[model samples]
Target: GAPPPPPARAGGWAGAGSPLLSPGEVRSKPMTVLQWEKLSMGKLAHTLWGDGGSDGGAKGAAGALEKLMEPGRAFEIDISALEGRFARPDPSARFRRAESDNSDRSTVGSADGGTPRARISLLEPKRSTSVGIVENKLRGALGGKPLRDAILEVDEALLTQDTLKMALSAVPTTAEQALLLAFQGEPSTLDRPEQLLRSLCGIPRLEGRILAMMFKAQLEPDMDELLQQVDSLKAACEAVQGSAELQALMQIVLHIGNALNAGTARGNAAGFRPSALLKLAEHKAADKKTTLLHYTVEVVQTNAPKVRRVTALLPTLAQASRVSLEELRAKSADLARGMDQVERELTALEEAAEKEEERREALHREAMEAWSAAKEQRDEARRRHREGRAAARASEGGGGGGGGGG
Candidate 1:
């Protein structure tokens, strides 16, 4: 039988060819690649050799591209899997190499394989800070307000592109991919609120949720993954058998894990009611194991430092498992304080409004009373005039009759 359909794609030129076509039949070997050699070296140097001066690690990759593109040579480009390094994991953070000439590009991509991604917050928080400071200074120099607006406009514009759809479509980094994609924009590149949101987003899906949060915020993916990751952590915890911190961590981890099963059947979908994500699991370690409520406090307490520490320190803390009673009380108090202040403000506004309404009613009553009194006076004067005229007419008739003497 004849050879099958040609391969679908090749190195940057997608949809231009088909599969099942051999190198010989396709005539796509290194020989036909010579034309690229004739292109301008300035552009070529940037493309092939890569930037030698900076990011010494990527320099090798660039050089490899240059060698493959050499004229009069036959070759084909393919990659089994691509590896990517992330600078910043925070959504607001950008992937950059100032020294690298190619810093202009949003993400480092391989034509065939996807690029790697990470949250800036997860690694190198210091670098994240320096980038932010530089951007702030630049904006200050350039009249600030317009720069931010302009950047937002650019990002929004890019997000609407059909071609960008291609980049976003590949289930490329299906696992926790949001944080990795955070470092894609530059200072002047953002073009709208959405872009800025996407830029400011941390840990991808989670950060995106916060930036795009509506009144009813929900985290679908993480809620789903919570169970599996917890199970792994729980087993690790039990196996450790020592360290109070470790045990506490395991307790919370198991709590979260149990929540996954307690809800709807998982696997078909990893989703939970916010009620479950918000609360701890039912399982309890009697006496000192702490109730689920206390477990929750332990969780928040443990994670607070972890989020900050994650910026510069190690992934030293995972799942934020320990919450002190005092910390829990403090957090609860703070939450209540916020609600109280809002209530007080609302009450004061309502009282002032009510008073204003009462004053308006009083003024209306006074005006109506005055108007009624004036109308009564006008009516009474008209009645008296009519009566006097009637009396005068009666007297004139009687006098005329007497004078006639009839």
Candidate 2:
């Protein structure tokens, strides 16, 4: 029979006579034996002397030259069998063999008929402190604010494609290869691009579930502390609102202000607004050595030293001022949503694992741990929300009573 369809171009190139095709275009077309022979001869001549060109051009020349040099001689290769000779043994197959043979040195023969991929030892990963200081700083900063919002502010930059690629590169080769194989097939559930990425990166199919657990680990403490800070701020605001000594000092300030403006049109006011407090520092004496607030502080300290306790109560308002209640609640709600999603995914995994014939005990155990941690975080967040609400209600009631008295 006539030479079998010219062997599909190897190294993905077409004849030099044709346009230099891109990688995507190269696979779609094939060259005839005569064309391949001419290209091949040119490639051999170039290689022997110098290609003096790009690598792809040189390879194309080589592939064509290969056909010319072997004219009339049949050449064939069994690609399926190539794996045994060139590729590493499937990790799962090695694991199964290791189990059955009860031997750790499960071997696979190489192209040279030598058992090269045998008794491969697993190595421990090296420890690095690249992000230790940053992690600590993040945890510390989260002491006073919502963590999710803070993380969201920079998560886009931190979790970029480059970062994921670096993370994938760090995974062990066997684990990485196994993960890639598991996701290599078309995904029945995930988007094509996302599945492709997960396949390439060695990320588990249920990584969203795993990632939620990871996030909870990092954020739960911050959630707890933020709730406490919110409560403290509410308590402080309530303290400021309910302090009779503070109210008395305010009355003195109003009286002094009205007396100073006695002859002016703005004199003898029924009450001074709270905003007048901010203007106290702006009012300077003739010598400019003291502010009106300093004088007021002296007067209060001299006549009612007990009222000085108001300064200690100011921290609650100060802390509260730094946080937006609306944004904080939104972050809390987001955490609750994330936990709910994790719970749902865990439920789905459990259901799927139940019907499987294989022993998925390890997968089940991992799912359970993630589920437990997520549930605990959800419970803690719910409890803190309750406490924050009660504190807020108390603060509101105290302010309402104080306002009613005024």
Best by lDDT: 2
Worst 10 residues of 2 by lDDT: 28-37
19-46: candidate 1 lDDT, tens digit per residue: 1122323211111010011122233232
Show model 1 residue runs off by greater than 4 Å: 1-317, 321-334, 395-406
Q: State which candidate has the highest TM-score.
A: 2
Query: Per-residue lDDT for 264-317 in model 2, tens only?
Result: 344444344456777767765433456667766765554445556667756667
Q: Which regions in candidate 2 have their CA more than 4 angstroms from the true location?
A: 1-207, 257-275, 301-306, 309-327, 347-406
lDDT of 1 at 279: 39
